[model samples]
Target: MSTLAPPLRTSWHLKLAVLSASLLFLIILATAFAQPAMRQNVQPYLLDLARTNPDNTVSVIVQKNSKDDASLEKEVNRLGGVVTKDLHIINAFAAELPAGQAVNLSTYPGIKWVSYDAPVQKSLLGGLICTDCVSTTLLSNDYDYSINANKVWNNANNSGAWLQGQNVGVAVVDSGVTNNLDLYSKNALLRSRLVAQVKVNTRASNAYDNFGHGTLVSGIIAGNGTLSLGGYIGVAPQANIIGVKVADDQGLASESDVVSGLQWVNDNRDKYNIKVVNLSMNSTQAQSYLVDPLDAACEILWFNKVTVVVSAGNNGADGKPAVFAPANDPFVITVGATNTYDTATPTDDTIAPFSAFGKDETGGVKPDIVAPGINLISTKPGLAVKLALDHPDHLLEANINYMRVAGTSFAAPQVTAAAALLLQSEPNLTPDQVKYRLKATALAKKAKGSWDTRASLKAYDPATMGAGYLDIYAAVTQKKITDSANQGVPVSKLLWSGDSPVNWSSVNWSSVNWSSVNWSSVNWSSVNWSSVNWSSVNWSGDYWGD
Candidate 1:
């Protein structure tokens, strides 16, 4: 309810990079310190209230008082502006401000803390080493990269044949970065299409990335080879990466900034033929409004035939039900976390202790699926830069450089990279089709009926793991039209929570030859492939006799 003072005269595009995962981004405080009421002589941080068409205003959420919200709203109204969005607790976009301004934002009333919006840069150096035979060790060191290589070598149409001339494009909408030789050597990282870049301050420019999160995320998705754990590599080693630096070095981003990034991708999705978008950031608050800017952007991407993957969040059991904004949005593919190599135990695919869960205020399951996010390793920015400088291929093993970190953020790019490979295999699949194939064909990491207890092998629960673990080979091979669920095969009863409905409005029995079947007791007449309600329907029965 904070009132905003208007008429700063600078109306730059406000891009708010909202969070979907925890490990992939740097966050910043949204609101900066404004004129402090009842306190004179104390300089307050200034909040940038970017006016979007007067009716919609994106405010940089800073530390402020609840009582002051109303006053702030009044102040904004005075300037012909409205307080459209104020995410008080989760400020991932605040990283764009200068250090002094960022400090002022942290001290405002009721402000717990402000995180800077950091960008995710690509690991160019890693790419250079891996593609060359001399840099084979670059793919050996990291476990996550090993897993990715395994998935790709086994499923990507037999040893990288499908990747020929594809040059799959991925958008890393986090931090800005410069082109380097490591990525250039293997032709893995593409810097040519810098569709757009925005910075809060003109001094640093969009290329500035202090937090180094964006570079890391991009490297995970497409780092060809600069260095290896011993010899590790990214998932889509040959894919082209587009760095969208929405967050500043501090890792903070405003809501508008996030929306602006999405809009940019949506407009340019066709130009680059960008297949997938990986968001590793998260928002603390679950947006209640249907027309939320983040959600709207997701829907736009979905309609434009672009796959959007988001992190479930890192707010598990901290306070409220583990839910994050944009991640919770229905249109976006929400990913949760699981441990790598724990399939034998019930803990396998169980939501990571730090990973967020999905349930609305009314209690509904969230996070459509979970991937390996815990203790996962991937590329780093500084290391990539180092690799480029040394040109590891030309240097000795001692000259190689790379980095590793773990989080749900690290896990998200795996799926994003997988989607890119899937797109390569099935170039005609729509975004929704890709999502369904991902869920439908995912191999169960654990057995059935396994709960909280960490057994050797257990079943994946919809409440926690959702449709099970990611299986690239099966997903690429699985036929959507022949899927048992789509074929009207029998699926067992399942217990689901949330707003899922049981009734169908349209059904296609062509796959089953059920045109002559009775319509009285069966729900065969109203199954809509486009809007299949997963929560309300169970596919377990389809496999029993199929």
Candidate 2:
């Protein structure tokens, strides 16, 4: 309901070093704090935030070690910091303090970690991240055969009406959603399937698809295509939606905006029967899920029984080492883009050239699943919307308006629809079960396909593709089983949740291994922490914060 403000104590000192002037970065590396028993609790990025802000006002989410959130609030209040939110779900609270005092706050005896509220935006190509730069690679508009959405849609109940994801709600945390005909409710009393519309970004005029990307993402998940006359239906036509706007009209957003949006989802999940959350965007940086504040926010929702789906970034062809957060976080189902080539068969599907590939911060092959992202068509608000205006070539309108856009940003919604469909059928599958089923039943990308042609026992690459392409039919029909995907994974909160010995401070902090997130992969020389310059990265509603 309010901005993040918390108490701060400027008692501790943590030095910020620019390891490589050639590369923009601010990392503690824990070399200075590696004394007798001091644990590096404050994230280095927060220090950078304090140093670069013109106003010197920094916001953060502080995680506590043992005591309740109230005690932590009192401590923050004593330090003259503003206590913004009491994040009970993750044993943490959001607060705003003086920029340079984050390390002092981290020194609190009970505090576990302090994370910077960084900026998050759309998951477009790394350098080419602009509304106008993203090319409209429209191949064809066929969802039924491409991802087998038709099979799931065809299965009807005894009542004669098929289970087109009826009533199961998905929270679209993006720019905004338009109340177009495709999203209108089947019931006469309801205005649209969007059961709720909340705006985290108060700067925005209203919660509508002025940016246009949110409308497209919303349509991909549950658009009925009432305007297209069955020509372009979404994965779950009958599924309801909840629009949570985190970005402004121009599609720019901060990580705090997203965290607030996720908080809204957590608070209202049961009220709207919200089962899935579609995050087709990511943060502007790539930090380990263990310390990344955004990961904690998304994990809170996943723990509260909301299945979170995220898109891998568009850094595939660029040779980047990892995907951005919360996609880099393993708890949620992270999806990548695949060029379906307008074909039903899986033999020809290849990970989109621009679709993000390679390992995440944890060194695990990212994109738990893949879906058609290139040249995909979905509902558009209008030609005046930001995305449509930025790339008019993407607007392929008939009697009803639709836009063709490409990137992992668009790919993730297909899986969100699949998650909704599965939840609609069973209504009891946990987030872990949903993730396990999707990865287990996915169509493994084969080498017999026309491209790589390399012979091997396993057709898919364990380093990049993870499981494989999306098969909604197989995923939804899988045996309803319960299992945990993050059994040995780091909890992300406790001091040194994942101790790599090789990474971090070299002063082993925790017992958990954090799976195998090779922190060494992060290039210290290339990270840019200076005031996140967005003059070039015009993320058109793909707010995937790192």
Candidate 3:
């Protein structure tokens, strides 16, 4: 009995030792996996910056698990960093620390990511152009007719009532907007539409636009055409404007400032009934939307029902990665520029020369729509006019009241204005619904055949033109759109038939009976492409750009 007892005791101790060893092995394995996650949380550019300038101070976006501002500040202090800004909305902090030290913060407990403080700039390509300086014709501008806004106003539902974006609110987050005569005239209707103005930059004493970009963008969105005497009414002439001044007088904004402005918009959305926000600038750095702080901030606004529109950028001519941050994100409506050929006809409209295009890192096609940005005439801030007058070559054709400008920056506001119009019609529509309707109802550019010179030149592609040009009337009037509130349609389904080489008629437009249809007899133009699910379509090796 004594011998048996001893053996039992030995076996129990052996089991205990084995269990301890196994637990230790698991701990080591967990640490091995955790190290990579920590490394990945740090953006690649930040790591590169650390390696190149270890001792130099760098600005970083430090994300944390806790929302407590005090704790976040303490964490930054522990890492030998100074907190520059507290972005409570995103549970993040902007800090300045030695580049080498910033990398070490990634290993700290509760730290989610440490990204470089990326810079953003206003995206303007060309100075404004004057089409006819001598003429005083009161005709609708080419941009208004190009997007069919005039038709939407004159349609039966509106019956020439000027659907003037009543009660809709649009927030322009850019360089501050000045008190332009077009927006702030004593006319009670136009004056009352400037709902709220907030200056976000520390350097700016007031909300006046010194840089000229924001005023131009705002004019494109909600300008009442007061200066032009109703000859240049914007897409949503009656929409309320919320001026969010994120950039300074120089038209430069940091990632932190932009994020802060977005946060402010989210907070004050209900106050102003701000249903739309226009981001007419682009971040210079091209990071994955999955990890970009700006992209995350933009998504927050989108999920909260604020329809955010961003510029795809003017970097296409550079042949670099064209789609910029925030714009690269799939959720926000990224708009590209299209040239209207100084005429209102749809056939002559071509993709703008400098409009950026490319798939995001997730392979999501971008620049969801294109609008008239070439030589567009809109309200000009007083300072902008002064600068243009100083350099006439920079002016397209400037008058005392308006400036002609071109860029995806201007293009974005057109879409923003369109969004205001849609929201004015259906205020209950979710952000996804608004996006779906716009893309679904967009007009397909007139095909120029296979051997057309434009096709040979590779001027436009799905990535560039998106769901084609903005058709405001069709977007507002479409009755049978698939409500995308639950699930988003893929970009492949919206690709223009002419852009793809595949025979689409053989594919399903609505049903799965691919084998039952007469492929040759199908009318490609008549088929409702919006209702078709092209999930099985392969767009691999498709030409995006240079």
Candidate 4:
């Protein structure tokens, strides 16, 4: 037996080589098989968009054909995504899918979530730069407050023709307004004005100004008084103010409270006929509707015809972009801050040092546009208190006069005022159309490094300030019409099977008559509530909360 074995001796090197080759082949096969499945259900296409627009997000819209949408959801989760909303086959899921996924469409299936994002700007102003910059008019006893009595009447008050039937209203949803002499002194609320000071907290009951932020914001939008030192008049001083306080005396408010306040606005928009709503708040992250109260409220407002404005957070300069919420929404009008006085050809409207930059996890351009947010002057509620302490000479008893401050918060109201004026000039415009008009009418500033004094007058680019500086005059006078017809899947008409009532909120239903396809009225009683498209429903009249 030993001799026979010796005669047929085999080489160990050949056997070892074969074994290694087989192992390598197995690895190759495993890798090839796993890659496709990993990408099969993930939304690979949205990664690029997310990367390009840091401040913006992509909404993955997926169509579910199977039972419970569970299979589709499971696939999305495996690919490391959270489901933001659930839509019946008729309604579409609009999810703020996070960044960092592969960009190839071949990686995922049933992934339809892909939407461009918009920012949310706020109202009011603040910063240390305002300390020495208080208006000097009050310091001099010679200050004649009566000198500019008629100055408050600008484009917003153009009598007759262009301003006749085109009346508009703005809901200053913030800290309650004070009856300041500066505003009331000049009759800022033109007879048609309606004010509702809703409490930020039910316990507090009164939305009184503990911190003067809201008051200042309101002044910037419609204050009629002269600046104590040096400041400009608000963009629109004629629009009505509806105060829904979300911040408290401590200068803070909760997302839930803000949502409730917005709900109040939605319930009463008809009474005020509020056309523009300003929200100058921020949240670091955009939670899914399952967990976020503010996002849900905003969805309601955005679906309605209200033009909502929000801030693009102040978290910045740490290499990573600051987190700006609500403004991250696709439907809302997001505004960023820019330094004032840098009006060169290559507009030096670079991201403010404190202003947050946009980037997907992988880095992207964020912030739709920039406004003059730095060192602005607006109204302050505690102005009476501060004025009594800082400048007793300027105080007028019982007259909630005006003061100044600075921040993106204040900058937002300037835009809001501008928007209010535009709305007043053109009442037929829908929220979306108004947004398009604003973007289209904005004047292009010089690029960061471009040589042209006016690089271009075209619509915005994602890389630079999205649509450039907002020009209210241009938005109001532009001959082109902005179309606001929502192309999204309409959920308002869909019927839903849920514990919550499927009908539109009584407030939404009562405010306006929806466009009907047939001669029959589409009131709640006439329509087959059961057959209605719940997917298109907008419970909030026209403003996103928080």
User: TM-score winner among the candidates?
Assistant: 2
TM-score of each: 0.55, 0.63, 0.60, 0.54
For residues 1-546, what per-residue lDDT tens digits would candidate 4 score against the true structure? 000001112467577666665465345334423453342222222444544642233455553323244555654453345577765522234345334322222234443223222222221244212221112121111101111112223223222123211245677666566645434423233443336677856544466655555676777676544433222345554456777776555445555566667777777777878877887777654332222345445546655567788766665545465444455555567676655431211133344455555632223344555566554445556644432345443333223344334356665676676667677767777777777776665557433222223345343345435566665555666646565522342232212222232344433433333322111111223333222122211111111111
Comparison by TM-score, 2 against 4, better one: 2
List, residue by residue over 233-347, the lDDT tens digit for candidate 3. Answer: 6777767889998876665566667767887898898899999999887766555565555666676677567899998888777665467677888878998888766555455
Worst window of 10 by summed lDDT in candidate 2: 131-140
- Each prediction's Cα lDDT score? 0.48, 0.66, 0.65, 0.47
Which candidate achieves the best lDDT against the true structure? Answer: 2
Cα lDDT of model 1 by residue, 185-246, tens digit: 35333543233344532333456444456665666666655443223456666666767766
Global local distance difference test of model 1: 0.48
Query: What tens digits encode model 2's per-residue C-alpha lDDT throughout 1-546?
Result: 012232222434412222231122122223223342444356545655655651366777776755444677776665557889876544567888665446556665776557665433233345332221111111123444567776666423211334578889899998889888888754442567777888889778999878888889988888776665444678887888899999877887876677678878877888998899988777666567766656766776776688999888777776665677778887888888776554334555676777676665545678888888776778888878877776776665333388777778888999999999888877887788888877766777453233324223233555566787677777776664455466545545522232432243442433323333333222322333333332222342242321
- What 10-residue stretch in candidate 4 is worst by lDDT? 138-147
lDDT score for residue 157 of model 3: 30
- Candidate 1 regions off by >4 Å? 1-138, 141-149, 154-160, 163-165, 178-182, 185-204, 317-320, 341-350, 360-364, 383-400, 445-459, 480-546
Q: How well does candidate 1 match the true structure in TM-score terms?
A: 0.55
Q: Give the local distance difference test score of model 3.
A: 0.65
Cα deviation in Å at residue 335, candidate 3?
Answer: 0.6
Error (Å) of candidate 1 at residue 51 is: 66
Clashes of 4: 63
